[model samples]
Structures are given as structure tokens and as C-alpha cells.
Target: MADGKNWRRAGYVGAGAAGLLAGNLALVTGSIVRAAGRTPAAVDDGPDPLLIDPPQLMRSTVAPTGDGTLLHVETSLDLDEHPSDTVLVLVHGWTCSTRFWNPQVNQLAQHWPVIAYDHRGHGLSEMGEKKVSVAMLGQDLEAVLTSTLPAGKRAVLVGHSMGGMAIMSWAAQFGANMADRVAAVVLTSTTARDVVQQQLLTPPTLPRYTEMVKPLVARAFVAAPVPLPSNELTSRLTHYMALGRHARAAHVEFTDELISRGSPRSRAAWGAAMYRLDVAAGLHALSVPTSVVVGSDDLLTPPLHADYMAQVLDHNGVLRDYVTYGGAGHMVPIERSEPYNVLLDDVLKAA
Candidate 1:
């Protein structure tokens, strides 16, 4: 009789605990959804404006993967002034196109050759395969390097977000010859793994409920509707997720435009892959001079990722530099263009 009573008591306690956890999880999810619908706080008019006018550049089409996926490549080379031995290749992040690098391109193209391209299923590029993975993105990048860059020329690769992940994937698969053709690498606002587990969607105070909430967060990304409505809610949500608290309305609009242009199917496909991403080995495989940049306020790919990446690269005999932007978010390149441009110039000159 005593044993039976103890067992009943334990069962009741467990059920109560489970109910509490479930209620908390529901609250968190509801909060996120409501936050997405709320209007974003307005910002004062600021002098920080985007560099909208880009220089006229040559356009070319290349089949990087040889899998019938044609990548749209743009280059601005003042062949009269600079040598063709080295070039700067810019890679944009997820849901973004070559246009994301316009500021950098406009600033750097005057001194050196600047090349930018849209990833598969982004911008002008056609979706090549039914299935998408980081490995496939790496293969596409390799194809771009092989076809667009001259035989003996080298490049300083600059990648952001998914673009950065693609670079890591490239290093993992093509690390053997990377040192020869790649002069330096810049990985901005990216990660090597644990993206889903360490995501900031759920509050850290709820450590006990993190595992339970992760799947819900991941599903939200994978199931997000395409051509997101152009409303105050959508604007607020984009600003919240991609930019820092100090972002202007104009900046938020620009980011929302790029994000909304992305294909819904492609977005979901890539989101699924990112949820399960683990490329720590790829970071170690990077043998060239590398710079890792992240915004301190970045919620998606936190600063811990940059710290871990720097640690791994240093351990593997690779000269690495880690930079953090205090008030910036995941969109470091756009949010802090002045510092970012200066950093890129320094890296390119060093390369």
C-alpha cells in the first residue's frame, strides 16, 4: 500500500512538471508570433544612407557546378590600373542576391577587380537541383572559381551568412588546393554548427525547455510563407531578426525587399539544411589567412560561433582574426558599412 501511494505521487509530480513545461513553451511561441505582428519602433532620420549607385560592370554567365545551374557573375575590373593576378569575390547570405554587395563593390572596384555572383536559386540564378545542401553550395562555388577566375590568378573570398557556410563547405571538400588559389577568406555573420540548438528565439532563462522549443522554431522557418506581406508587422519582424535595434526604417525596408524576393520553396529548403548544419571540420580545414566577423547582437549566429571558429583556425596553424561589431546584428555588412568596408579593404590589401 505504501509503494502504490509513492508511485502515484511521483506520477502526479511528473505530469505537473510536464504541463508546466508545455505551457511555458506555448507562451514563448505565442510571444514570438505576436512580436512578429507588432509595429516596429520608429527611428529618427539619420545620415547613414546605403550606397545605391553601383559602377557599370561586365556581366557574364558561368556554369559553376556543370550540373546545368548557370550562375550570374558580375565583374568591375579597371584593367588599366590594377593587375589581374588577384581579385575580390563577394558572396551574399541567405535570401540575398549579388546586390547585397553593392556597397563593397562600389568602393573596391575602383582600385581592384570586384566579382559578385548570385547563389543558386537566388537573384538571377536558376534553381539547378531538386535538393539543396551546403555541400551542393560548396560545389557551386568551386565551379564559379574554376570558370570565372583565370588559371593562375588568386582571389580574396568574402562571404556572409549562408555564403560563409558555403565557403566552409568548400574548404572541407577542396581544402587541398585552396591555399594555392585563395589568398584570404572573410567569413561574416556565420557559424560552423549548433545553429538550431543555440538560437536566440527562446529565452536563455528557460534552459530546461530549450530542447522542446527548438523544433518549433526550426519548423517556423521551414514553413514561412513566400513573398511575405509588405506590412508593418513584416517590417518589424525582419528588422528584429536581421538588423540591430538601431537600424533605420530605410535599412529595414531594403532588407525586407531582398528577403521577400527570395523563392519560398528555396527558402524552406535551405532553412531545413541550416537546422541540421555541422561543419566544424570545415572551419579547421581552412588553411589560408582568415577573418571571422560577427555582430555582438547577432541572434541567429551568435558571437560564440565566431570565437569557436577563431579557436579552431588558430589551432590548425591558420592565421585568423576575429572581429565583433558591438551594436550590429546579423546584417553586419549592411548595418555597419563604414567599418565593414574598411575591414574588407584591409583584408584585400593584406591578401
Candidate 2:
């Protein structure tokens, strides 16, 4: 009887020790995040005139998710202008809306028909059921494509960050139809795997510490009690994580507005999905002609991701071109719009 009682006491002690260790790790991570928050952001001298305005000639439509959710889709047609055979579909990243592609719409809409849409729980879209996953995002893309594009029309698909991931998920589920519907694909600043493991935000020397802190960071991204506001700290963090160091103040502000407007629940839900993201094998199914673009200074989805994607696409005999912007960050679409636009135009024309 005494031995059994001692064993039970030992079990209690072991559980208590584990709880205490976890509590200490959480406290440490909290302190690090707070320290990062206190750092000041560098301000740019002036705003770029080109980025000051939003897109015009946009028509909004709603596409049902078939699961009681409605997505907000914006289509720009050059009916009396330089209309072309190919349609350009733009997908924005996490914490962003269709407005995130305003610059691209402004440049591309005058030539080809352009379609941009907000993900579930973003922008003018209504949030459906609470469950969110990458598969759901893929389904959303499929619905938007089916509802927006005409029959027998093919599209040149462009996606940034999580938007790029959505394209992969879509290809995975609907690869057979992709050859007929998708003319080409452009993946910008995205990865297929090792997102958490290969992140550059945390230092390499502290692997164990980073592993402990990753879950906390993911939680904060989705649903922090006191959410990070549109302040200097938030701006600084956005600039660091998403934009280039040479990014203009106007660009940073533009990016921050879209990010801050995101729904916390949606953000958290999608963030949890990102934690388990692994669509590397799905790349094999993406048999369409493809292009990859990345920023040299991109801390989120660094150049290594671009390299791996290029290699995989090439091995599959589907690579078209791989381009890297020097000193650019994850927000390559906005940071280097002139060249990025030109590159996109070239891809569209080639397709």
C-alpha cells in the first residue's frame, strides 16, 4: 500500500514540474516579444505619389462558398481598351484583402481582364462557419474562378505569400482541370514546407528556444488579448517582416492598413493552418508552366524557398523562369512594383 502511494506522489510531482517548466518558457517568450515591440521604426522622408491612389474601374461581385459563406470578388475589365485573351487572377496573402492588389490592378487592368478577391472573413466578404483550413482556401479559390471567369477562358494565376500557398492547394485538389483552365502560374515570396523550421525571424543558435516560442508567436498572430495596433511598433514589425528596409513610408502605411483590418479570429484560424502547412508533394501535380519570384532580404519566405521551388519545378519539367529582386523583402509586389509589374506583364504576354 505504501509503495503504491509513493508512486502516485511521484506522478503528481512529475506533472507539477512539467507545468512549471512550460510556464517559465511562456514568460520568457512574452518578454522577448515585448522587447521587440519597444523598438522604434524608421520613418521615410516622403510618400511615393504613385502609391497614393487606389484602383479605379473595379466592379465588385459576391461568390458563394457553397457552405453559407460569400466571398467579395472585384473584377476589372478593359472592355473598350486593350482587351486580351488571358485573364489575370490575383490572390493576396494572409491578413490582406483584394485591395492589397490595388497597384497590380492599376497597372494590369488597362490591358487584360483582372480578377481579385478577398478570402473568407476578409474585406467585404462574410465569414461562414468557424472552421478554417488551407483546403477551405483552395475551395474558395475554385468557387471564385468558376463564378467569375467565362466558360472556355483560361487565366494566368498570380499569388503572393499565403496566396501562393492557396494556388498550391488549389492545384493539389484540381490538377486535372488545371491544364485546361490555368495558362500559367506565378508564386511570389512563398514556401511549400518548413515554414516554421526555416523562418529567419528567430536566430539559428537558439533552436530549442525558438521551438518553444513558435507556438506562442502563432497564437499572438491569431488572437492576442491586447492586439497590436497600427502604431510605430506595429509599423516597424511590418516593415521588418514584410517590406524591404528601403520601403517608402507610404508603402509601409498602405501594407499596414490592410493587415490591421484583418479579423483576429480569421487570422488566428489561418495562422494555425500555416503551422501544419505541407504542400511540397503537391508541387508535382502543378504541371502548368510556372514562374517564381523572391526578394533577397525576405525574412518570412526567404530565397531558399524560391530555390527549392525552382528546383522542383525544373525537375518536373514545368519551370518557366525564376527571378530574384536584390535587397527586396517579402512584399515584392509593392516594394518593387515597377519591375515586378514589368515581369508580370512579360509572363502574361508569354502565356
Residue-level lDDT for 104 in candidate 2: 83
lDDT of each: 0.79, 0.80
Q: After superposition, how far is residue 328 of candidate 1 from its true place, in Å?
A: 0.2
Structural similarity to truth (TM-score) of each candidate: 0.87, 0.87
Considering only N, C-alpha and C atoms within 3 Å, which residue pairs clash in candidate 1?
none
Please tell me which predicted candidate would have the highest lDDT against the true structure. 2
Candidate 2 TM-score, C-alpha based: 0.87
Model 1's alpha-carbon lDDT is 0.79
lDDT of 1 by residue, 6-110 (tens): 999999999998887677667777666665555346465753444575756655565557677788877664532457577888888888898788678767777
lDDT measured at residue 243 in model 2 versus the true structure, 0 to 100: 76
The TM-score, computed over Cα atoms with residue i paired to residue i, of candidate 1 is 0.87
